[model samples]
Target: MSQLERADRILDTAQDLLLRWGYRRVTIDEIAKRAGVGKGTVYLHWRTRDELFLAVGAREAVAMIEAVAAAMRADPAEIALHAYMRRFFLEAMRRPVLRALFTRDTDTLDRFLSSPARQPLQGAKLLASREYLGALADHGLLREDLRPEDLDYSLPTIAFGFFAIEPLLPKELALGLEEKADQLADVLRRTYGPARPPSPARLAAAAPEVVEIFERLAREYGAVAYGTTKGGDPEHGS
Candidate 1:
C-alpha cells in the first residue's frame, strides 16, 4: 500500500484502539499490528504515540470543519452565530471523536487529549472558533457593543459547560442532544444577536472565508499532530 494509505490505516486503528481502551492503555505496537504493518512503520507516520493520537484528534477536527462548512453552504442562515452553534454542537455530539474531545470524559480519550503538548492545538482551535464569532460580528450579524475578549471567553465557556455537565444529569431529566442544542442556539442568539440580523448576501459572503480560516487551522493541526510542517502532503511526510 501507498504511504498515505498506510498512514490512514494506522490512524483508523489508533482511533479504534483509543475509543476501546483509553489513551494510557493503547500502545504503538498494537496499532501497527492491527493495521498489519511493522511497529517501525507506525513511527514513519507519527514519531510518538502522542503524535499519532493527536493526528487522530486532528482528523476529527477536520471532520468538524467540513461539517461547519457544509452547513454554511447548505443554508446561508447558518452563517448566523446561533444557527452555526446549533449545527456545530449537533455535529460534534454525533461524532465520537469530537464528542470525546469536547466533553473530555475520563472513560473516553480524555487523558490523551489533556496532555501538555496537546494544549496548544486545543487552544488554537478555540481561538479559531472565537474568530468565527468575530467574523460574524464583522458582518454586523452580532451585537455592535460586544467585546472580542468577552466573546473569546463567553461562547466557549457556555458550550463547554453544557458538554461537561449534561451527562452528569439523570437520563430521564436530560434533554435529547438536538433539543439541548436548539435551546443553546436560542440563548446565544438572544444574548449576542444583532439588533437586526445581517442580510443573506452578507452572510453568504462571510461564511466561506470564516470556514476557510477554520479549514486552514485544522490542516495546521493535522501537520502538528503528524510531526510534519504545516501544509505538508500526507503522502510525502515522514
Candidate 2:
C-alpha cells in the first residue's frame, strides 16, 4: 500500500479504538495490531501516542469544519450567522469524537484535553473571529449593535452550554439532537442576527467569503491532523 494510504489506515484504526475504548485504555500496540502494521510503523506516522490521538481529534475537527463549509456552499442562505450555527451544531452532534471535544468529555479525552493541539480545534474562536464576524456584518447578517468582542465571548459560551448541558438532563426530559440544534439556531438568531433579514443578494455575495473562511480552517486542522506540521497555528507551520 502507498505510504499515505497506510497512514490513513492507521489513523482510521486509532480513531475507532479511541471511540470504543476511550483514550486512557487505547494503546499503540493495539492500534498497530488492528491496522495490520507493526508498532514501529505507527510510531513512524506519529512519534508518540499523544500525537496520534491528537491527530485523531484534529481529523474530527477537520471533518466538522468541512461539513459546515459544504452546507454553506450548497445553500447561500446557510452563510447567515444563525444558519451557520445550526449547521455547525448538527455537524458536531453527528461526530462522536468531535462531540467529545466540544463537550470536554474527560473520560474519553483525559490528558489530551490539555494538549496544545486543542487550541486550533476550538472552532468557536475560528468561527467568531473578527474577520468572520465582519464578513457577516458586511452582509447585514449580524446585528448592527453587536461587536466582534461580544461574539468572541458569547458564541463559545453559548455553544459550550449546548454541548455540555444535554448530557446532564434526564434521558426522558432531554430534547432530541435536531430539536436542540433548532433551539440553538433560534437562540443565535435572536441574539445576533439582524432584526431584518439580509436580502438574498447579500447572502449570495457573502457565501464564497464565508465558505472560504471555513475552508481555510479545515486546511489548518487537516495539517495538524495529518502531521504535516506540529501543533500550534497551522498557518505558519509553527
Candidate 3:
C-alpha cells in the first residue's frame, strides 16, 4: 500500500473512534491498532489527538453537506423537499459526534440551514420551490402580497421545529418522525391554499431542476467522502 493511503486509513479509524467514543475516551493506541499501524506511525501523521479530531470533524461536515445534496436527488416527486429535510436531519442526528457538534455548532448550522443566499451548493438545489412559490404569487396562483421571505420562514420554521425539536421531546408531545413530517407538509398546504391550490402538475414541472441538483448531490456524497480521504494531508512527515 502507498504511504498516503496508510495515513488516511489511520485518520479514518481515529475519526470513527472519536465519534463513537467521544474525545476523552478515544486514544491514539486504539486508532493505531484499528488502522493496522504502529503507535509511532499514528504520531507521524498528527502531532496531537486534537488535530486528528478536528480533521474528523471536518470530514463529517463535508459528508453531511454532501449527504444533504444527495438526499434531494433520491427523493420522489411528492417527497422532494420533505424527503431532503427528513433524510438530512435523520442522517445528522444518528451520529453521536455530529449531534454534539450540531448542538454546539449553532452558528455553523445557521450559516448553512435553508438560507440559499449563503449556501450555494445546497441553495441551488432548494431554490426552485421558493421561486415556484414566488412565481405563484406573481401569476396569481396564490395571494399576491405574501412576501417570499415570510413564506420562506413560515412553513420551514414549523418544519424545522417539528423535525429538530419534536424528536427530542417526550412521547406525549413527540409527534414522531412520520407524523411530524405530515404536519409540516400540512403547514405548507394550509399556507399555500386551503381553497384554490396551484396545480401539482404545474408546481412539479416548474421545480424539476432543484430536485435534480439534490439528486445529484445524494448520489455523489459517498464518492466525495472517498475523495476527501485522498486529498487529506499526505502521510505527513514522510
Candidate 4:
C-alpha cells in the first residue's frame, strides 16, 4: 500500500478505538495491532497517542464540514442561519467522535480535552466567527441588529447547550434527536435569523460564499488530520 493509504488505515483504526474505548484507554500498541501495522508504523504516522487522537477529531471535523458544504450546495436555503445550524447540529450528533469533540465529553476524551492537540479542532468553531456571521448578515440571512461578537458567544452557547444538556435529562423527558434539532433550529431562527426570510435570490447569492467557508474548513482540517500541512506532518515532527 501507498504511504498515504497506510497512514489512513492507522487513522481509521485509531478513530474506531477512540470511539469504542475512549482516549484514556486506547494505546498505540493496540492501534498498531488493529491496523495490521507494527508499533513503529503507527508512530511513523503519529508521534504520540495524543496526536493520533487529535487527528481522529480533526478528521471527523473535516467530514462534518464537507457534509454541511455539500448540503448547502444542493440547497441554497441551507445557507440560512437557522438551516445552517440545524444541519450542523444534526451532522455532529450523528457522528459519535465529533459529538464528543463538540461537547467535550470528559468521559470519552479525558485529559485530551485540555491537551494542545485540541487546537486543530477549533477549526470547527469558525462557524461562530465574525467573518462567517458577517457573510451571513451581508446576505440578509442573519439578524441585522446582532454583531458578530455577540453571535460568537450566543451561537455556540445555544447550539452547544443542546448537546451538553441531553445526557443530563431523564430518558422519559428527553426529546428525540430530530425533535431536539428542530427545536434548536427554531430557537436559532428566532434569535439570530433575519426578521423575515431572505429572498430566494439572496440565499442563492449567499450559497457560494457560505459553502466556501465550510469547504475551506474541511481542507484545513483535513490537512491537519492527514498530516498534509507543514507543522502538522506527524511523519516528520508533529
Candidate 5:
C-alpha cells in the first residue's frame, strides 16, 4: 500500500482497538498487528498512540461536517430535517470516539464538550444548520418558535446521553438508541419553531423514528456512534 493508505489503515485499526479496549487497554503493537504493519511502521505515522487516536478523530470530524452539509440536499422538509439530524446524532453518538475524546480516555467527556475547541466548529455548523432550519421554518415545517441553535444542541445532546449513559443501563433499559434519537429529532423539528407538547403516546411512537435516524447515521458515519464495542455508556446524562 502507499504511505497514505498505510497510515489510514493504521488509523482504522487503532480506532477499533481504542473503542474496544479503551485508551489504556489499547497498545501500539496491537494496532500494528491489526494493520498488518510492523511496530516501527505505526510510529512513522504518529509518534504516540494519543496522537494517532486523536488524528483518527479529527478525520472523522471533518467527514461528519461534510456529511451534515450533504444531508441538507435531500427532499421533503421533515424527511430532510430527519436526515440532517441523523447525521448530527450519529456523530454525537460517537462522543466516545470523535465527539468527546480526551474525556472518555482521560475521564473528561463533559469537560471537553464544554471546552473552547468545540466553539468554532459548533458555531460554523450552526450557520448552515440555522439556514437549513430557516428553510424548514419557511415551509411551516417546524413548531414555529424554535431557534436554529436548538438544531445545534438538542438531538446531539440526547445522543450525548446515549454515549454517556447507555452502557450504564442494562440492555432493556437502553431501549433503542436510534429510535429514541429519531423521536427526539421529530420533537426538535416540531419544537424547533414552536414547542408543541407531544402526548405520551405520540412521544412513544417517535421512538423507532429516532432509531431509524440513528441507524442511518451509524451506516453513513461508521464509527462515530460512541465506538464502544462493549458496555461503555457515558455517565448519566445531565
Candidate 6:
C-alpha cells in the first residue's frame, strides 16, 4: 500500500482498538497486526504508541472539522453561530472519539488524552475551534461585542459541562443526547449569537476564510501526528 494509505490503515486500526479497549490496553503490536502491517511499519508513521493514538485523536478532530466545513460549503447559513454549535454537538454524538474527549472521563482513556505527548495535537485542535468561533464573531455571525477569549472559554465549558454532568442527574429526568443537544443549542444560540442572524452574503464571504483556518490547523497537527515534521516525534531525537 502507498504510505498515505498505510498510515490511514494504521490510524483506523488504532482508533477501533481505542474505542473497543481503552488506551491502556492497546498496543502498537496489536494495531500493526490488525492493519496487516509489521510493527516497524507502524513506527514508520508514528514513533511511539502514544504518537499512534494521538494520531487517531487527530484524525477524529480533522473529521469533525471537515464535516462542519462541508456543511458550511453546502449551506452558508451553517456558518451562523447557533447553527454551527448545533451541528457540532450533533456531530459529536456521532463520533465516539469526540464524545470521549468532551466527556474527559478519567476512569476511561483520559490518561492518553491528558498525556504530555498529545499536547501539540490537542493545542492545534483547540486553536482551530477557538479561531473558528472568532471568525464567526468577526464576520457578524456572532455577537461582535463578545471577546474572543470569552467566546473560546464559555462555549466548550457549557457544552462539555452538560455532557459531563448530565449523567449525574436522576436517570428519570435525563433526556436523550439529541434532545439535550437541542436544549443546549437553544441556550447558546440565544446568549452568544447575534440578536438577528447575519445576511447570507456575510456568511458566504466568511466561509472560505473559516475553512482555511481549520485546514491550516489540520495540516500542522497532521504533520506532527504522522511524524512528518522536525521534532514531531517524541520518541525520536527532536
Please provide, for model 6 over 17-85, each residue's C-alpha lDDT reduced to its tens digit, 9 standing for 90 to 100: 888888888888898789887777777677778878778777776777778878878888887767777
Report the Cα lDDT for candidate 3. Answer: 0.53
Error of 5 at 17 (Å): 2.0
Report the lDDT tens digits of candidate 5 across residue range 1-238. 5555666787788777766766667789888888887877666656555656656665576566555544443322223455456556675565557644522434333333344434433444454445655555554455656555555667456535545554456766655657766765665555453354434444334333433443344343333212222232122210
Candidate 1 at residue 174, lDDT?
57
lDDT of 4 by residue, 14-53 (tens): 8888888888899998988998877776766666788888
Task: Kindly report which residue stretches of model 4 are placed more than 4 angstroms away from their true locations once superposed.
Answer: 121-124, 228-238
Task: Predict model 4's lDDT versus the native.
Answer: 0.80
Relative to the true structure, candidate 6 has a C-alpha RMSD (angstroms) of 4.2
Clashes of each: 0, 0, 5, 0, 26, 0
Which lDDT values do the candidates have, in the order given?
Answer: 0.77, 0.80, 0.53, 0.80, 0.53, 0.75
Which scores higher on lDDT, 5 or 6?
6
Runs with alpha carbons beyond 4 Å of true place in candidate 2: 120-128, 229-238
Which candidate do you rate higher for TM-score, 2 or 3? 2
Worst 10 residues of 1 by lDDT: 229-238
Clashing pairs in 4: none
Comparison by TM-score, 1 against 4, better one: 4
Which window of 10 residues has the lowest lDDT sum in candidate 4? 229-238
Over 4 Å off, model 1: 225-238
In order of appearance, the predictions have TM-scores of 0.88, 0.89, 0.51, 0.90, 0.53, 0.84
| Residue lDDT tens for model 1, 13-112 | 9999888988878998888789887776777667778878878877777787777877777877887878878988988888787788778767777567
